[model samples]
Every structure is written in structure tokens, then in C-alpha cells.
Target: MRAHRIALWLAVGQLACSPGRARTSSSPEPAAPVVVPAPTRETPRAIEPPPTVTVVSPPAAVEPTTPQVDATLIEGPAAPAPASPAQHARLLDSPEDPEPKLRGGIVKELEDVSYIVGNEWSLDAFREVITGLGGGYVGVGPDQAYLMMGWQRPEFAWLIDYDPKVMRVHAMYHALLRHCGSRKEFLAAFEPEATDAIAEVLDDAVADDRVRRLYRNNRDMFRWRLRSIERKLARRRVPSWLTDDETYVFVRELVLGGRVRALRVNLLDDLGMVGIGDAARELGVVVRVVYVSNAEEYWEQYAPQFERNLAALPSDARSLLLRTRLVWQVNRDYVYNAQPLQDFLAWLAAPGVETLEDVVGPKPPAQRDRINFVLTTARPP
Candidate 1:
């Protein structure tokens, strides 16, 4: 595999230099020495709320661990902890791995952001819908945060993925933003700084609490995350815009002023670590939107757990579950695809539908299909 990759890369390199083929902005030639701004103490302006008026509470003290939910953690007067940028930086010091509650309680599979370069054509549509629905989002998947960057403009974004490597990737991003001020310097230093010997990186960050803890306990995890990011870049995941320092600053500025965060949270957590409802209440805002991607398509068998998770999230009439759909599964007739589905479900919950066997088969769509499926609490239960 290594040899094959080397040969393929060599071919690509040759193509880049081979001829007088005029390159577009998407494909650039050699890079020039770009001067990225040094880390600045620039205070970011407060992000204004979206059309639907989403909100979150003030920043609180960063917690040191993800202890399993207890009485004090779950229903207390203290609102759910905001997934602040500074709060995530605190995870850099986690002494051990934070584990997601798995079904079998066994490690059967492990991977995140597999360096796959493909047509993520739905990203534009996802961004459009979420932006239209307004903000306050928590999503599941690796790097989907990048997908929602410009448009979603969320008040709070929780980028949750199942894989530890995925969370580590996010952590590396956290470290970068905490350290670098502008794009050019970030592009130059991110890999080198994060991937260096743990001791060396720690020396510069001696005063940072998160940095010190990361150096002490979670150094190996940080190294793997840095390596994964570099691999993704080699596979061309890094966009051309990020290459230009000016554009980098421009894009980053448009994204929330350090309000987003990345973390390891499962959709099936019994107590709900990615507590959308809890956070919303704590932040004094409604969680108007959520992006589950196609997770439901593959994990629908765990519906009981997933349903409980959703029920726990604080939602209202305006809230919507943004999901995709498979073409084959969509019903052309019912149109319960919108409000009626919830009504039909409410009916089924009562005892009257027991005699009707016809309602058992054909159903709603999956989120990954050409026409994605969305869920809303349009009908009063």
C-alpha cells in the first residue's frame, strides 16, 4: 500500500509540473512564502443571534473530566456546561481516554476521518437547510463542522463523533486556534507544533493548564490526532482557500468567535453527554436544529436508546431533526413525510391502530438519500 501510494503521488507530482496546463483557483501551483499574523490578543466581537433567535448562557468554569452522569451532573440547577472553546482546551489535560458508552461494551471497530476525498455533494444542502431553520446545532460526524462553517453561523456547535481519533483531530484544531492568530502561521505551524515531541511542545506551553495536562497524560492521543490531520491534508482535504493567509483570516473570522467546540459524545448515551436539551436550558436558548447525518440509517436498531437521547434534548415546535433519506425508502403517496407522520405516530401510540396491519410496512426516508428526510414536532402530543 505504501509503495502504491508513493507511485500514485509521484504520478500526480509529474502531472503538476508536466505541461502548460493553466490551473484554476481550485488547483494551485507552487506556494510562495506567506506571512501569517503572529498570535494576537484580538478580542472577537460577540456573534449575533440568527433569525430564529437562538441563544446560550455565559461561559462557565471548564470541567476536567467526563464523569458518568449522576444526580448532581444530570438534573441539577446548574445548566449543562457550554461546549466553549476554552472548555475544550481543558480536555487537553485528560489523564485517560474518555470512552463513549458502546453497545457491546467492547472495542470492535475504530476509525475516523479516513482521509477519503469524495463528492460530499450534500454539504451545501445541509448548510442551506440548517441556516434556514436558524442556529444552535449539535451534529455527529468527523469534520462536518467544516461543512457548516460559513452558513450555519450557529450560536453553539457541538461537533460529536464516535471515534477517539476523530475527537483528537478536533482537539488538535482546538490547540491550533488557541495558539495561532492567523491562517498563514496556522497552516505553517499546526502540524509541526502538534506533532513534535510532547516535551518540546509542553515547554512552550508551560503556563497553559490544558497544555500541561496534555503533556502529562494524553500526549500519545495528541500525537495520533496530529498524524491523522497530516494524512488528511496529504489526501487533499485542505482547501486552497486555507493556503492563502488572508483568506484564512477572512474565513475564520466569519465562523463563530470561538463559540464552537469538538468532543467525543455518543448519540446513544443513556444520560446524554451530548445533551442538546441540557445545554439549551443552561444557555437559555432553544436547540432549534440538530444534524444526525445518516447515523440513523445504520444504527436504527438501537432506536430505543436513540429515542431516549432525543427525548432528553430540550426541543420545541420550531426544532427540527435534519436527516437525509434513501430514494427507495421514500413514500411517494403519504406525504406524511412532513407533519402527518408525527400525527400518525401519535395515533399508533394509542390502542386504536392495533387492528390495522397495513401500517406496518412502507415508511419514511433516510437522511443520506437524494431527497433527505427531516423530522419536526409539528403535531402536539
Candidate 2:
């Protein structure tokens, strides 16, 4: 029995050890795949891509280069622009530096003379008078003091005794009185000296001999002519009514009388006494005074009379007389017959109107027209 039991155990062990097969009972086979109804429209599905990974290396660095500067370029601060030609010229032409101020004392000295002389005398005359009084022109101080360089000249040293400024002032006073005298006679008395001074100045300035000779001739002729006229007027034996104040009054009254014709006739009749030449010469002066003092009447009477008188005189005499008449007329018109006879004489003595030709011949045709127009025009009351 034990052996039997052993065999059975061995058999059981062998059976247990052997792998057992699963039961062959089959599950029901899946129902034949019912073709899922094909979708009404077939749709394509997007395919998914597989994910990918990558590795990369770092990049290498490039070397840097230094910038270069251009040497020819104008890199420094800009230079100032050049000046234009006109600007340069103006700079060159500028006036020189002013002289230093004169000393106060010297200025005072000059002022003294200036106070007395004022602006009446010409600059040349002022200088001459100052120099004549032992004063040097240079180094003069305003206080009327002189700086002496040399001790030897006593003439200059005399300045120490007399004030040069005072002397100069006095000299100018005398000079003015001499040249512009109060009375006609006094002025006439100074004529010779005046003529000399004028001649000297002329000599220095006028280089042309013809012009100088012409000037001298005219002066001599005027003197002779005037003297001759005066002698004739003296012969008239008419008492002198032409004192400084009365002359203008007498002239004015005669012009007012429609007596321009009568006065002219009276003048012509007195020709023997007035000398034709002198009458002619004085005509302008007389008429001018008449015109200015009594312009309305003078124009009415004198303009026509002047034409008549001019016509009456002989051709040669006409020029001389006309010149004289013009002189009278200008004096009356411009000077108002207020000037002394001496002043009138000085004016005549000037360069341009020194002769008869200057009086009449050169008168423009326009002047004749103007004169005629005045004469024929109706009087202004």
C-alpha cells in the first residue's frame, strides 16, 4: 500500500509540475465588423508630425578696426572771413588823430581878439593882424602867454612889456574902423591902402598876366571916369541935398511923382553939370534907390525912363551909362540905398563890375525882356 501511495504521490507531483492548458471554450466571435456606415462625405484627418530636438554651437567674434582721420580737412576752429575792398579802403582813409588842445591862456588870448573882431574880418586879415603885433603863430598858449625860444630878439622881448593879446585886439579894432569907416569921406581916405592890400593879394593868387592887366586897367578907368562925373555934377551948382539921411527921402519923393519922365528930363538937362558919363554911371545907383524906397512908383516911372535914357545915349556912351545905371539900380534894390556912398564905392571896386562893359553889354536878353515887361505893365497903385 505504501508503495502504491508513493507512486500515486509521484504521479500527482508529475501532474502538478506539468503546465496545464487553458480551457478551449471559445468566446463568441465578434459579430462580423458591420462596416461602420461610411461617413456621408469622407473627411481627411491632419497627420501629426513626430517631435524633433536639435543642438547648436556658439558663434565666433570678429575683430574691430580703428577709424582714420583725414589730415587735409579743415578741422580747427574756422578762421575769420577777410574784409571786402571797400571796408579796407575806408579804414585806410580815416582822418588823422586830432591835435592836442591848445593851452587855456592862449585860448583866452585868441578869444579876446575874437570878441572884438567877431566874424567881420576875413580869416587872412585876422591872422595878419595877430602876427603884426609881435606874436608868433606857433606855440601860442590860451592864456595869451608866449613860449620864447631865443632871448636875443628884443622886438619879441617887447612882448614882456606889452600884452600881445591886448596889442592884437587893439590892432584889429583899428583895422575894422579903417576899413569900414563911419563917414564916406573917412572910408574914401582909406581907399589907397585898401587898394594896395588888394593888389598884393591879387598878385599872389592870379598867375595870368592878362587877367591881372585887365583888372588893373578896369580899376584905373573906373577912377578916372568917376572923377570926371563928380566934376561935372559939381558944375551944376545945385546945392547938395544928399546928406546921409536926406538922400533916400529926396530920391523916394522924385520917384513917386509921375515925374519919372520929368526927372529923367531934368537929369538930361543937367547933363552939362552932371557930365554925361557921370550921370550914366550914377543912374543905376539913383534909380535902384528910388525903386527900393518907393518900389511901386519907381517901377512905374523908372522902368520906362531907363529904356528911354538907354535909347538916347550914343552907342559908346550907352554901355558906360548902362553899367553905371545898373550899379545904381542894384544898389537901390539889394542894398536899399541904406549903405554909405563909401560902401557903395567899395562894392563897385570888387572884381567883376569894375568897368562900363560889366554894366551894360553883357546883360542877357532875358534881362531886357524883364525890364520891358516891368515898364509896360500897369502900375500896382
Candidate 3:
């Protein structure tokens, strides 16, 4: 029995000491790392590298086409309203006033009447006649006459004298009577209180050169009769040489009224007569002639033919015919236009025209021709 016990103990000890048996507790061994082959055409397999991770970045973003909606999205404030129709209607309804009419026939008659003359009278004689008749004359040439007049006065004058040639004065008087309304109306308007005034002036007339000439010409007889009528009207002793013609009274009235200035013919129209030596004798007024050579040469050739027909005119009548020479020159030169002359003449006829510096100022030589051209073209009948 003792032998058996000892063998058993030895077996147990041998089992515990066995080489494949665990003697103490321990964790199981990890499995061996698996080996994978690279992918091949036939036996494709994925090979992973030793835990090496790779990071990939994404692409950049793009913007949208439509605008983004706002957080509030309510409609904006409304626009202001337009103006009303009543305001526009009120602006268009206002009215305008009428203008006054001008005195026409009188102005027309004054423009139409012109003086004419023949060659027999000296310029001085012609001027005296004009002055006596209460008109102003400016001699433009040896044969020419320039007469000017204004409203309310005899701006121009002519005397009725017997002339075998031209008979212009007779024609003028008849034309004036026909065209300027009745002689009675003209006489009354122009020579108010004529008889009384005539008698007074004749009584005061002395034996001066003017008085002597008046007597020698039978003007004294005419004046005596005129003064007798005036004295009877005035109940006073009247002088002779005062009453000559009713026209004389008409003229005297103009002079006394300061409507006329008795200028010498040689002083106002003849440019040749206007130098320092003779100018002082010409009185304060001066005259100038503007000859347009271009037209004058042409007219000179034809003027003689017309002169025979014109020769029978009185000296005053002939003077008027000569003044028309400028008109002919302008017509021949083709520089004539009627409107500007009419406008200028109209301006001249306006009240106080004498005081306008621009109208009466000294003109340049170049401009004088232009003025002549305009005047010749524009003068009324």
C-alpha cells in the first residue's frame, strides 16, 4: 500500500510538470498578422498599407442666379400722385386788348405832293419863292430843288406862276386840289386868322430891300389888298407887302409857329457849296450832295433827251424835276427798294424827329451813298 501511494504522488507531480500544460493563468496569444497579395488580373485582392490614412478635400462652391429674398419682403412705400386738370385750364383763359388807329389820308397827301420848277429862275429866286410860300428849299444842283415839310405846317412850298414850259406848278396845284381834298379845308386849317395877321405885318413893313422888291414885283398891290381885308377884320391900319396870296398867309402861319426855318437853297443841297469859306454864309444848316457815279454816267447820256420835254416847266417846277435825277440813278443802279425809304420817311415824320441825334448826326461818306440809295428808292409819290 505504501508503494502505491508513492507512485501516485509521483504521477501527479509529473502531470503538473508536463511541458504542454499551463502552470499559471495567462492571455491567449494574438493571431498572426494576415498577409494579403496585391491585386492581379486573375485573383484580385486588395492590399492595405500599414494603417496609413489619406485625407481628400472637396471642390469650391458657386453663386445662384436669382436675388436672395430679404427677411421682411413687404412692398416699399408708394410714389406721389400727378397734378389736376382745373389748374391747367385756369392758366389758358386770359384775354387781350385792342390798339388805336392812325390818321391816314393827311399823311398820304403830304407824301404825294412834290414841287417842280423850270430853268429860267435863279436858285436864289426859287428859294425866295419857296420861303414866301412858307416852305423850305435846298438847292441840290443848278437846276435841282429839295423841299421838305412836316405835319401841321407847309413842309414843302411852291408858287403858282405862269410858265409856258412844263407847266408843273399848274399841274401841281391841280393835282393837289384833286388829291389833297378840298382847297377850302386846307386853307382854313393852314391859315387861320390870316387876314388879321396880314394887315398888321403890312402896316409895319418899312422901305427895306424886301419891301422894295415886293412893290416892284406887284407883290405890294397883292399885299395891299390882303392887308385891307385883314384891317377890316381887325379894325386897324394895315401895311402893304403883307397880303400877296392866300398861300402867303398859309406860309406865314408856319413860320410864326416855328414850323418852318428859312434856309438858303445854296446852303443845304449843294455839296459843292459847303466848304468852310462859304459854309458860315450858309447859316447853321448845312447841305451835302452824294453823287453815285455809276448811275449818274448812265443817266447823263439819256437825260438830255428828256430835258426838252421838261424845259417848259417854271424854275420851281424844273427844280423838282432835277431832284428826281437821284431817283432815276437809283433805279438805273438796281439799288432801289421802296420799303426802307418809306420806313425812314415815316420815322422822319414822327414828332420831335429833329432832336434825334442818330437821325440828324454827321454821316460817313460811305454811308451817305447808302442813305441816298435808300431815300431815292423809298420816297413816296
Candidate 4:
């Protein structure tokens, strides 16, 4: 397999260099040099709420369903704790081994900016299942990540996506979360009237040139998406990080404390996925929940590396895997699915388990909020 990959990569390199093909700016840029910023303290601006609005108190934290397992320290010299948010962000980058290249022709070749907001429609369905299983998080996409991370209050979060544009939007999210004190202020920054505020925040918080440039270029679209998210959360009456003060503060602290990291990492990549597992282990953080957001729909069969990556994550009996599938037979949008990590691994290991449909079945439960399922069995936990 190693020899075959080397030969294939050599062929790709020849093609890349031999042609007169002009590369487009839409392609993901090469990794940037690490620059840790000096830590500075600033009190967030406090904003008052409207007279009619009522704030919901965040629920008390819940104990893990199972006992926590301590991570056995990696047998090597230990690194000192990171001093700043930038330093922590640097830790989440792809590891040096396996060279961090993507599969499937740059791993999902489409580079257009993502739906900066999610289309999942019913993330609230996951609130009870995922809440308070705090450890570390690995997931894809934009706002949906924040929602799950907020509910779980994970010790750290790595928002991994194949698209660099998605990473740029997440960069913007980090900056906005860092600067905005109140939920009102955070959502307001996405409005046209807050251009100056947004500029100040972006200029100070985001250091990567490519991330800042791309984000500014598509600010309008992002602003629209974020505002739409707030409207949807309100219309649904779902208490979220945007709608609740306590949830907002928790997510804000994760960002400000430098525990939230967003990066481009393909799930099937040997480097990034393994790197996430190793990083989590070194930090002594269990990956309690992983939200893939319908990414499985893109592939018909699981790659060998996919199995390896899932195994590498340090999980316990209580650990959960969350995904959404557009089972049109149930709802026009998506049906949220959650499974115990152990059960999911068992299903993946079973013979003839080729795709999501093989595991989740041809149709989801008619009551869309359901979670547990066997290869052909669906049941409520």
C-alpha cells in the first residue's frame, strides 16, 4: 500500500508540474507559519437586553454515563502547556508524519465557501443526548459545531472540515466569539450596521492573511447566513448559544481560552485524523462526541483509513457518534442519528456494512428525533 501510494503521488506531482494549467485562487493555500500572539486581556463590552426578552438559565452539568478513563501519557518528553489561544490553536494542526495530503483529488474538490450556516433544521434534537458529555469534540461544518460544543461544554474542540473556505468562516466565528461579550453583541456584529465593530474584531483576532482576506471578501454572505441562523433559532424557540446567555458564555470561554480550533482535515487522511486522536490523548481528553453532519452521505463505502481514524480516537462506553442523513422517506431535510461509539465500531467491523444505509437502514424512524439503530433495527434508547 505504501509503495502504491508513493507511485500514485509521483504521478500526481508530474501532472501538477508538466502542464501549463493555471491554478485558481479558490484552491486551498499551503499551511502558514505559526505565530503566537502576546496574550492581552480586555473586558468584553456589555450589552443590555430588550424589555420583553427573557433569558434561560443553563442547566446544571451532568455526570458522565460511565466512569472517566485517564489517558496514559504518550511515552516521550512532555511539552509545556500552551501560553495563549494562538499557541493552543497551533497544537491542533496536522501532525508531521504521513505528510497531511488529501485523498479523492484534494478531498472533496469543491472549494466554494460552504453554507456558513447549517441546514440541519433540528439540532435541538441532540441537546439532551450530547449535553454535558464534556471532554473534546471533533466535527465538521460551521454553526452546528458551536451548538454541539456549547451543549457538551467540551474541554477542547477541533472543528475539522475538508474545505478551507469552511475553515475561514470558522476563523471568523472564533474572532467574533472572542470580541463579542453578549449574545446580542455577537449577533449584531453580523449585521450591516456593525461593520466597524466587525472590522475591529477581525483585524485584532485573525492573524492568517488568507483567512482574513477570504472572510472579508465574503462578509456579506456570511453575515446573511449568521443572521439567518439567529432567526431560525428564534422561530424554533430553541435555546442555543445564540439564544441563551449561559450557553453563549460557555462557548465564548472555549474560544477565548483557546480551546476551540477549526482546521481543514479530511476524515480519510492518514495524517489529520490520527493527529486529532494523538492530540486528544496527549491532552488527556476523551472524545465524547463526534458530529459528522451528513458527511457519510458523500461516500458509498468506508475506506480502511476511515476505520483506523475512528479507532484512534480515545472513547469510552459513554462516548457517542452523531450524524444526520437525508432519509427522504422520513423528512424532506434530515434525520439525526446517534450511536454509542462501541456499537458503531461493532457495526463498522461487521461484514457487508458498506455504507450508511447498511447501518442506519433504508428509512429513518418516522419520529425524526430518534437516535439508536442497528443494521436493520431502529429503536429508542
Candidate 5:
């Protein structure tokens, strides 16, 4: 249809030449109104990526789909021997100090929505695979921040989601963690501003206009969220360093040092422009771990987009992706339709086996809360 709609002016011009005269068309009508919203959030980077993702007013245009190019998941002609624990520890660096630096866009249209994920329900199996890789980008689910904060200790960590608002929720928590030195102090930030004068004073800097606005808009939800995190932390078994004071200091250092960035990005998208993908390309970064909690289960049309995201990343051997899948029981009344994480680089190398069903197998596993760990490193660094 597009090709068929050529200018009738060409036909008309030919006829007019017979009379040796040309006619001009009237002026075109005004264009449609378009508005763009400014990018609402960016968690600090190892070296902060400037100050914005540049969300516009009317809304940004959809990003072009990335053309699928195959990457081999098979072993290469030669590979390097793995680094030893001592060398790996040197790569882990210290939690107290982080190298700050700067680091996609947009099928996600809703910027104001976010889910409140409290606990970081863990699968112990991922620890070795995750920790094996040296420092790089670490992306995780909406759960407890401590596990990744303590274990992976990537050079930079990004809390990613399809919802900008969800990222904003993380931003609020980052603010709390950065400013409040104790669990009590952090909890107090959500209390009525009237009562928590100390919290307001301490939290004031962290509580940017957007964070305060989110608090003002959904007063109850945000409060409930803060309480939920407190309860989750209270119940979990974590490293001693994760004690409230330690966690606060760690988070404070990370944010201020620009080693932690919370991005509201669709994992299925190319993510080349705004999130960790951009950081990888722009900064020559090698990402070691990316965790997507049960999100792949919800993908429909954008399903293949996940593959694109994996392809976009530049990685080294030992990189891991952690994901969760729900297993249903015959007698159970409730079950979630989530899938496990896979070695994305391997999936690309192997032939056949195209969809999630291939990896999860035919029947739902009998166990409860099983997590899948996939090796994503295609070759040695």
C-alpha cells in the first residue's frame, strides 16, 4: 500500500507539460501534537550516566525491534583456565568502596506503576555460579537487596523491571537505605511526617521531589511496602554484615559512590540505549549476572525480545542468569506460571529447542520454589 501511494502530481505534471504550464498545491495542514516525558529515574552508576534517561511528555516512540542474530553457545576453539578464588576475591573488591561509572528504552508505556516486592526469596544453588564471576553488572528481581548486595557484589547493580514506577519504588528504598543509618531510622521515614521529624530531616536529601511525590500520592501503599520489607528482613537468615547498620552503610556507599543504579526497563527490549545494555556498550563493560524473577512467564509478543537483550550484552565466561519458575501440584489450589533461568549464551549455540517449554520439561516439577541457574558465558574472557 505504501508503494502504491505515489504522488498523483507526477501523473498530473506529465499532462500539464502538454500545455507548458505547472500548478502548485496549497500548504500542508498542521502536524499532530506530540509530547515527551522526561526520564523520571536513574539510580547512581559506578560512574553516574549523567542525570537522565530523557522520558518525554506525550510519550516516547516505540523502539525498533532488534534483528535476531545467532550467537553460538558451544565451546570455542580455545578457552582460558578459570580464575582461582584468590584472584576472584580481588575482583570482588570491597563493599565499602565501589568504582562509580555511568552506564535502553521503551515498550513499557506505563511509568507510574510498580509492584512492591518485599523478600528476596532465594535459591541457594545460584550462589556459586553467581559469585564465580568477577565483578560486572548484576541485575536482580524485586526481592531482598542483601543477597545480591552481599554475594555477587558486581561492579554495578541495577534493579530492573518493565515498570518505570516499579523502578521508582526501588529508588525510594535506595533513598531510605542511603540516608537512614538504622532499620529503625529507615522505618521511620514512612511514618507520618508529622511524627518522624528526625527521619524527615535525615531523609530530606534522599527524598527528592519525585520520591516525596510518590509517598504523597500513595500514602498507604508506600507505608505498607516499607513495613513489608522490614518484616521480610526480620525473618530472613542473612550474613551478619547485612545487619541494619551494615546494610545501610553499604547501600549509602553504593549509591553515593555511583555503583548502584535502579532502572525501569523491559528485559525483553533491546535495552541498548538506556539500561545496563547501554552501560555495557558505552563503557566496554562485561556483565556477569542478570536475574529475572518469574517475569518471563508473563511475556507474550515481546517474548523473543528477551533473546535480543541477552544478545546485546557483552559478557565473559562464568556469567550467570538467575530466574524462578513455579511448579504446580495436583492437589494445590494456587500455582504461578513462571519459568526458570537458562544459560542464554548456550541456548543460542544449541540447535533446535526454541521455547521455554523445552527447558522446563513437560510436567511441572513436584518440588516447591525451585530456582533454575543457567550458565551464560559462551567463551573465556
Candidate 6:
């Protein structure tokens, strides 16, 4: 019994002497250590501070890296819109005239082009005479009217033609000028290969189906017309809207402002010219320049309606009538003449003055083979 008691005492001593089981009765127990997770390879060291041994939350789930892209580059460029007539109205003092109806002629096919690009090679000569006469302009034909308008800088311009096709031509001009960014862009829109592209632009921009159809059907003719004008102007060394960027911008702004209108007007018609005159008078705008373009030669006698049409137009002392006649005596295609508006009216009023021949009595003796301007005197007081 004594040996067993001694063995139990040795066992108790061994247990109490164990290093991990050692304890002091007067000391308190030590606290447990906090657990902190180590950062992964995915964690961005520059953006986050290093994790400490202290208690903390796990890092938020890392978002996948994405490539940034511009929205415009993804969607591509947007197409342009048509010119706003509302914007145009804000620039004008008077309201627009009511839309005029077709009065005289309708051309059916491209082959029927009487004056797509006129043969007035000498129109540049009139620039000096017409410049600075900036009221309202009434003219016939297409490019020549624009050339004269560019020179004169009219406040408002009426492109009146007997043929409806000419108005269609003007609509094409409106579309091209309104949408094209620069002179190069303008010329390129008229290229033969650009037919479908320009048709698309016109389709988007022009509201008139007739205008679009005319352009699509007669692409070759219109292209040829523009190219011919470019070549002609280049050959003549004339600084025109097509050839000059500044002039093109000037004319383009005018078209964009809605100051230009195309109408089907016949000089001898009872209603069309009379309506135009009434519109001008209502607007309080004078017709400073009237370009008849050989239409006077068509009549042998002064039709009373034609006389009334001329008389009806509001004019000032500076107002003039521009006409062209093929004087074979002068070696050019036409002799350009400017007659004072009042004098032309007086000649039409005179009983003996029957024809255009009586008004422009004779060709100049000295002028030959060159563009010449014949300035008619004012009516005798």
C-alpha cells in the first residue's frame, strides 16, 4: 500500500511539471488571437493597403477588367437632316409667298433640254453692271441666274422659268448646296459615279418626289451640265461660285436661308407674272434686276399681258432689264444688253415700238468677237 501511494504522488508531479500544462493560480488566462486573411494575386497592391493581423472584412470581389470604347466609334456617324424652313424664316422680315402653281410648260424627258446649261458664255461681262444692285432679282434659266445672283447679292431671288424642269434643276441645286460641306464636296456630289449616293442624299433631304426623280432619271445630263460649267468657267478664267470657295459659301448660305425660290412663270401669262408682281409689292421689295434671257425675241409684238407684267413689277431708278440677242454682226453667240427698266416700259407703251428690234435698234459697229455690254439710255424726260 505504501509503494502504490508513492507511485501516485510521482504521477501527479509528472503531470504538474509538463511544459504546456503549466499554470499559476494567481494569473488570468490569455486571450485568443484574431484571424486575418492573406491577399490573393488578384488584389491590386497600388489601390489597396496591405492586410494587417487585426480583425477586418474580406476585400470586395474584384470586377473583371473591361476595355473602354467611345460610343460614337461604336455607332458610327449619323446622317445629316434636311434644311429647316423654320430656321430660314427667322432671318427674313416678311413671310414667304404662297406656293405658286405651274403655269406654262412641262418638259417630259432629259433629251428635251433647251437650256440645262445655257450658252451665255458672256454672262461674266454683266457682273460689273449688275454688282451692288442688291434688292430683289427676277431671272430665267439655271446657272446663269445663280451667276448673276452671286454677282448682285440680291436680298431675294426668283428663278422663274416657263419650263417646270428648270425648277426641278433648281431643287437639285438646293439639295446639293444645302448638304455639301465644301466646294470639293459640292462638285463631287455631281460626279457621274456619285449618282446613287447623291440620289440617297436628295432622297433624305428633298421633300419633292419630282425633284428626286428628275435627278435620278437625268443624272448623266446634270453631271455633264455641272462638269461643263466647271470647264467653261475654268476656260473663261472667271471667278464664279463653283470655281471660288468664298463665292460658293456665299451662295450656299443664301440657299440655306430660303431667300431663293423657283417658280414656273410665263412672261405673257395672265396669272403667274401678275402673282409674282403682287407678291413683290406685298413684300415691299423692288425688283432691281430682271433677266429675260432672249425671251423678248420670242414675241414679234408686245402682248398686252407682257407689257402689264413688266409694268406690274416694283422698280427703282437703278432697276434694269437684262436681255440677250444673237447678233451675227458681232461674232459672239449673243450681245448682252442692259436697258433701264423705265425705258423698256416706255418702249412697250409706245404705239410705234412693235418688236424687240425697235427697242434695240441696231448692233454696235465696233464690237466684234468679244463679250460686249450695250447700256441703253434712260427714258427722255
Regions of candidate 5 where Cα sits further than 4 Å from its true position: 1-113, 118-120, 123-134, 138-146, 191-210, 216-236, 240-244, 272-275, 281-284, 300-304, 327-342, 362-381
- The all-Cα superposition gives candidate 3 an RMSD in Å to the true structure of 60.8
Ranking by TM-score: 4, 6, 5, 1, 3, 2
For residues 72-162, write the lDDT of model 5, one tens digit per residue.
1221111123334443333233221111111111123311223343322233334444442444555544434445554455555555554
lDDT (Cα, tens digit) per residue for candidate 3, span 237-295: 11111212333334333333332212221111222222221322222221121111111
lDDT of each: 0.37, 0.21, 0.22, 0.57, 0.40, 0.58
Give the candidate number with the greatest TM-score: 4
Off by over 4 Å in 3: 1-203, 206-210, 220-252, 263-381
- Per-model TM-score, in order, reads 0.47, 0.16, 0.20, 0.69, 0.54, 0.67
* Cα TM-score of candidate 2: 0.16
User: Model 1 compared with the native: what TM-score?
Assistant: 0.47
Model 6, residue 236: distance off in Å is 4.4
lDDT of 1 by residue, 151-262 (tens): 3444556666554434444554555544667755555553335546443544464433334343333333323333433343323333322333433443354332545656
Candidate 6 lDDT over residue span 126-189, tens digit each: 6656776777788887567777876677767777766555656788888899889677898888
Q: Can you write out model 4's per-residue Cα lDDT over 1-381, one digit (the tens) per residue?
A: 323433332232210001011124655332111111122242212121111111111111111122122212212211123326544745555463331333232123321213344545556556656767888888876667888876777887888766554666688888877788898888777666777667766877777655555555445545554565567566555556777777787788777776777766777778777888888887788999987776676576887788788889999977888876543223223445577776677777878777766655553333322322211122222
What is the TM-score (0 to 1) of candidate 4?
A: 0.69
For model 3, the local distance difference test gives 0.22
Give the higher-TM-score candidate: 3 or 5: 5
**Model 4 poorest ten-residue lDDT run:** 14-23
Backbone N/Cα/C clashes per model: 9, 16, 19, 0, 21, 0
- How big is the positional error of residue 162 in model 4, measured in Å on the Cα after superposition? 1.4
